[model samples]
Structures are given as C-alpha cells and as structure tokens.
Target: MDNNSILLIDPTFDPASASTCNLLVKVGLDSFSYAIINKETKQVNAVFDEQECDNGAQKFAERLKTDSYLKLPYQEVKFAIHTANTIAIPNDLYNEANLESHSQFFTESHSGNLYCQAQNHFGFTTIFTLLRAIDKTLEEFTYAKKYEQNAGLIQLAEKLDGYNLLLDFTVASFNVLFIKNQQVVFQQCYEIENTEEFNYYILLIINQLNINLQETALNLTGIINKGDEKYHCLLKYFSKADFISVDTDLNQEVLDDMPAHYYSSLLALNQCV
Candidate 1:
C-alpha cells in the first residue's frame, strides 16, 4: 500500500534523481509536509502533505525509507527536518544543566525524548529542542525550527526601518516574527480564532515594541492574500502593509506558478543555521 494520502506532488519528478535531491520536511502537531528540491536546479520537483496518523511524525521519520509515494536510497538521503518547538535559551544565560529546567516551563516533556538544538546570533544564542523519535533522520539531515527559518527569510528582507512584522500562517495557527535594526527581536506562534484575535496580538506586539504603525512596515506570507479578511485587517492598521514575496534565486520557471510567499518557510529551510 504505497498510498499515504499525498496532497500534492510535482508532475515532472524523475525517480532516478532521488539520490541527488535534497528534501525539506516539516512535522507539525496535526500535519506533515515535505518538499523535494533538486540539487542542480534548486527547484522543488515534488512536495507532499499527508493526513494525520496516530503517530504521524514518527511514521514519516521511518516511512521515508520505504514510503510508497516515493522511492530513494535511504542510506544516502540528504534532507532538512523542521519543527516548531518553543524552547530557546540565550547564550549569555545558557547552561547545559539548566536547559531541561528552563525548557520544562514551556513544554510538558523535557525527558530523554527531548532533543536540543542551539543557534547563535550576534547578540544572543538560541538553544531549542526537538524530539528524539526522529533522531535517525537527523543523522545527516539538518534539524531546525520553522520559526528560525521563517525569521531568517524575514531578516533577509532587510527593510529594518522601524519595526518589521512577518506572519506565516497555516489553517488555525500562525507564526509571527518581529525584526528590527536588521536583527530579530522576538518571534512566536499563536493559534487564533478570528481576525479580531489576530489583530489583538498584533496590537500588543506593536505597543510592547513602542512601534508607530505609520512608520512600521508589516509584510505577510503564508496562506494569506490581498483579498483575505486577515490581510485587509492588517492593511487597515498598518499603512504600509505588504505581502512578502519569496526572496530566492530558485528555478523561476517552476516557482513562478506557485504562491512563493505561502511556501517561504518550506523553501527557506536551507537558510536555517
């Protein structure tokens, strides 16, 4: 049974190219998505979204070896794995022994199953965690937070004038990244029911940062467009609201047809440190 409820795949995928392809995988709370990117052309040849299973992520971790949807040499595969863990510690204040202590405040599980990752920025160091259930996949694949990769793309936009707010969205959840002075100030994920709740969070972020909507530029990505109510609400408050385009030199012919901003996080996985 090769069927795993794939939501999408590229039409031109060549099975012979799997060895050289670089895969980007994200296992979320209730869904999993992956993009198969070509090494030479730097374009996605296939992308897949699968239905939630009892242990969906773990299944994906193991199924990559023999999943019916695609075929490849599991022993020599190259990939990047993404997670949304909220645990992070600053370098100046980080302690190896204290990681479990600090992380416990954010997540219920800080046991051996919890795997940690650290990223260092100029001002502070970020130490985050992942799951050990997927360790074998990380033996060669890069493990990263969707927030970090999404934030990197936003910072790369480099419009750091007052405050830059970048939002990446899914069905009922979203990740918000705040960039200032060419550096990341804060980034967080929230699940909101409606536009009002989303607006409330935006207001708090702006007020906390002491930003002037007249000056701050709010650029958006992921699952939102010009006509969407969420987009209009943002437009109403921030005079300079704009939809962020995927900033890359990837295959233009292949990506021109896709909504670049919507897949910014998936496409920018290679940018994570």
Candidate 2:
C-alpha cells in the first residue's frame, strides 16, 4: 500500500467472484478511491481510498499497473472524476451543437473533452470537462462509463427531503450541494486550506442562499469526521449537522473499524446509473 492509502477487503471476498462484480473508481487531482461490489447482492467486497495525491492521473495509471484487484474482470466499470469544470443545464436548454457556449457557465476556463450525462429525473443534463490525460488513462478499462463527481451526490440527494445541504470533502477541498423541496438550489466545489477558510465558505453560503441553518438539514460525507474542526465549525451554525447515512444495503463488515459515513458518497457511486 502507498502512503495515505487505505485498503479494506472483506474476508469472504473471492477473486473468482469478481466476474459478477462492478468496479467503481472515483479519482481527482488530490484523491483516488475504488470499490468492488457484488452485482447480485450489492455487497461491497473491497474498498481503497488514497488522499492528498499530487497527480491523480499518474496515480490512477500506476494503480492500473500494480493493483491486483483492478486487474480482475468485472461485469461493469464506472468512473467518477472530481472536477470543478462542470455545469448542469436544463434538459430543454441543452444542445449538443452549442455545447461550446455552455463553457461560459464554468467558474474557470477549461480545455478538455466535454462529456454529458442526462439526469432526466432532475430535468437537466450535467456537462463536464475531462482532461485528455485522465480520459486517455481511463481507456485501460473495457466499456467503462465515466461521470463527474456530482453524479453520486446528486443520486444521494434524490433520496432526501426538505431543505438539505450535502457536503462531500476531500483533503483540501469540499463540494457543497444545496437542495430545497427536492430540487437542486446550488452546487459548487471550493478549495480550503484551514478551518477559517472553511468557516468563510459556510458564512458565504448562508448569506448567499439566505439559508435558515436552524431549520435546514446538514448532511456530511467523505473525509470529514466527528470532533474535527470542520465538523465543529459546521455545528456552530447548523445544529442539525450529522453524517450522511448509507442508504444502500452494502456489506458493512467490509468497512471494518472505519466510519461508514466517511465513504458514504464513494459507496453511493454504485447507485449512479
């Protein structure tokens, strides 16, 4: 195992059964994670998460060459890449011919291949940019489906009700999605260095959205934990803050002594069809 990496395999996991499993990989500039799940039972056989990486593409490529789990044949391979260069356009307003025009909505300029996912349930299509290197590296998998990071979070949000704030954290960045009455109100990823910066964003989000912290539910997932400064900071404003629960019937034993909420968003990748 590499530094900052954690791998957990269920005692009952059998390599021979991989042919009936699905491989889900979530990679970004700073982190990489993957889960092997039984297609029939939806049991997570294994999970691997590595954070604070310098070059995600290079790290993924190296894992393809070294990780034995990745070599096993699986029923399906799905990838969720983390990137801020993503925009969700209403289904009626989306036009493949005018995709270039949509880049204006991006917070930062990006030069990469555009990929779109039709989120018909939400009446919108998610358009995101994928770096050429990352796209090329993903070619190692056969018939792999690619998606942006928000796909899983969006799927998870669909199950929630009322005013909800979903936060998914990485080592130095966090993604926030606000949902009101089952519709997405705001979603964005922010880079933060310390607790103060994290607090700044919380305040900004509250003022920008006129959020009623007392009434709204704050659900957290990924990298964050109880008693952490970030968690405490969130509690200061939102007393309803709590870790998001895993809604799927996954094998909890696979997580062993780890907190299930820490990987709830990652595990939700299995639900992103």
Candidate 3:
C-alpha cells in the first residue's frame, strides 16, 4: 500500500512448476506472506511458509517477468543468493536499520567467473562487489579468490562499477565502492554469523575504510531471513541511511492454486520470452 516501498517476491520451487506465478510479500514488521492467485481474480490469497520457496534471489527476480499478476504498479523486484550454513547477518538488524529509498539487485554474473553486478532502479553498473566480508587490510586488498568462487556470482560482481552511482555506497554482504575518482575501487566484503557478528564486521569496515558516516551513506540489505530478531538488528545498526528488501511480483491468477514452493526455478522459463 505504501508507494515508497517496493514489492518483494520469494519463490522456493524448482522454477519449472506450473504456469501459475507463486510469490510471497511482507506486509510489515509482522512478516505476513501473501500470494498472487491470478492476474484477474486476485483471489485465493493466504499466508504461506516463508522458507517453503527454494528460489534464490537470482531465480526469484527472473520469475517476476513471467508471473501473471505479481507486477504491481510500484513493485520493484530483486533477490539474494547464499549457500547453506553461510550466515551473512541477522534479521533484526535488517528490520531496525534506517534505510533510504534507493535500492538495487545483485545477481551472479551471466558472463564470466566469480563476479557480481548491481542493478538499481536506473540501470546496470559495471562494478562487481565481491562478498568477502573477512578480515583484510588495504595493503592486502588485492583481488584474490578467498573462498571457492561461484561462477554465477563472479560474473555478476565484475560488472557493478561501469555505471553511475544512482545514490552512493553500494550495499551487499560488504560495503562496496561503485565508483571512486572515475575508477572502480572494490572494497572489503563484511561477513558475520549473526547480528552481533554483523555489528563487529560493520564496525571493522567503517574503521578500516576510514568511512565517515556523517558524510557517506549507510546502505545495507540482507539475503537471508532466519527470523525477525536478525531483521530487527540490521534495522538498529544502520539506522541512518535507507533499507530496502528484494521480492518477486507474481501474476494474480497463477497464485490462486497455491502451488508448492519447490516450483520456482521451473517457473522462470516465462522470462526467456
């Protein structure tokens, strides 16, 4: 109902499910999930499982194009991807963070190796902000592969800095530099197991990067949703800048059936058109 906020859709299926577009949306702090049953009917709406959908951020974004009715007028779609047992941050931080209006989508690059690209409301940028939120100094900031790289994610990161900075500092697992003095300077990616860990990492980045909170902006977004506690932590930690979430927009008619969550990947075929 809020014009300033964007629509979020999370599909947890294999992407090859029925033509019906199934997605979930967060109503508010309560995290009420809603589904699009049909493009015309708009019926059969109900609360569903938050984790039922297996579709990751990339796969979920692709689903928006095909969904019969997920596309609401002001809904901007985006997604997040992560491996199992890999905790980026908590949900409380995400919920309490004072966020701005501008947001973007980062997907595993379609082109090359472990790179990523940022997609904001404007257009695609050419800078890839790798998710390396580990301990690193400026002297050790060489572009090295710290963990086993994901080919899908690598290509996406490589193309993040070629475009204009719609707002300011890019937010991913780590605080990123979209453009610096006409050149793309990749910053360290922050990592943490929970909210406390996230705070430690965030502070570490601020201290090491010589970041001025008053001057620069704090833009943060998370891909995982373990619970409201973690979300609340993120909201409180970065309570200055804007906070936004990535979701899917599905056609209304497709959702009436209320299909299972595992059909997300199979549903993306509609985007090929």
Q: Count the backbone clashes (under 3 Å) in each candidate.
A: 0, 0, 99
Ranking by TM-score: 2, 1, 3
Model 2: per-residue Cα lDDT at residue 186: 92
Alpha-carbon local distance difference test for all models: 0.59, 0.85, 0.30
lDDT per residue (tens digit) for residues 146-215 in model 3: 2211211222233333431111111123223433333333333333345677666655655775654444
Predicted candidate 1: what Cα RMSD to the true structure? 4.6
Q: Best lDDT goes to which candidate?
A: 2
Best by TM-score: 2
Writing each residue's lDDT as its tens digit, candidate 2 over 63-134 gives 888899998989988888877688899878999898999989987788877888877767788899887778
TM-score to true structure, per model: 0.74, 0.93, 0.30
Model 2 sits at a Cα RMSD from the real structure of 1.8
Over 4 Å off in model 3, which ranges?
1-184, 187-191, 223-241, 245-273
Candidates in order: C-alpha RMSD to true structure:
4.6, 1.8, 16.2
| Candidate 2: 10-residue stretch with minimal lDDT | 133-142
Q: lDDT rank, highest first?
A: 2, 1, 3
Which candidate model has the greater TM-score, 2 or 3? 2
Model 2 pairs in collision: none
| Candidate 1, poorest ten consecutive residues by summed lDDT | 73-82
Q: After superposition, how far is residue 98 of candidate 1 from its true place, in Å?
A: 7.1
